[model samples]
Target: MLSTSLRVAILIGIIVYYFILIMLLRQKRLTLKYTLLWLFSGLMMLILSVFPQLLNGITRLLGIQLQSNALFAILFFCTMIILMSLTSIISKQNEAIKQLVQYTALLEKRVREIESCGD
Candidate 1:
């Protein structure tokens, strides 16, 4: 078992690294708003990862002591749902970019033809 101090230090390290990752995404010199979104997401993930017990904190507060196993199952389902949503969004973006690329290529080919004919 790790000492309490060590555990706290590790948690702090993880939080710092997660925040750094969000900052790196904004290294593209984009606005800070986008960076904040990433940072918030990171914080959410850290909360779920470090102290998953907080997920069930509500049950105890409500005076119903549910089994921890059930809490774990619920958390797992929540994580899966979030991941699926992300995947769906990514797929839609990919399809949109693919269509844009095809349109650009077709326009470029037409431009090339017009230039050749003008020669």
Candidate 2:
């Protein structure tokens, strides 16, 4: 069982985490789409911290012997999801870069042809 002080600390940390996220969003440093996952995770942590019994019940249902192990499992799963999301974003950016390069090459070729014709 988590000590009362520990739970209170976790809640404070979650609040700070949320404040940072909101600040980033307002500054346009973080997009809403990307922040959604983070916001969700923070909310989950807040709930779990406020009601540790919910996690205990879930841990028992999952047949996890230790609550810490269950927490680790959840953290790992969230990490994997974030990794996959980042990968997808990278892939899309790569494709956009390729298209931009091709377009630039085409424009350069046209400019060279126009200059040669003028000469």
Top candidate, metric lDDT: 2
Clashes of 1: 0
lDDT of 2 by residue, 7-102 (tens): 888789989999999999999999998878888888877877787777788787988876656666776787788889999999999999999999
- In angstroms, the error of model 1 at 38 is 8.6
Which pairs in model 2 have colliding backbones?
Answer: none
lDDT of 1 by residue, 1-119 (tens): 22356447646866797667756765755445334545555565456446656656656565545534444455466566657766877899899999999999999999999999999
Each model's C-alpha lDDT? 0.62, 0.84
TM for every model, in the order presented, reads 0.49, 0.88
Best by TM-score: 2
Off by over 4 Å in 1: 1-66
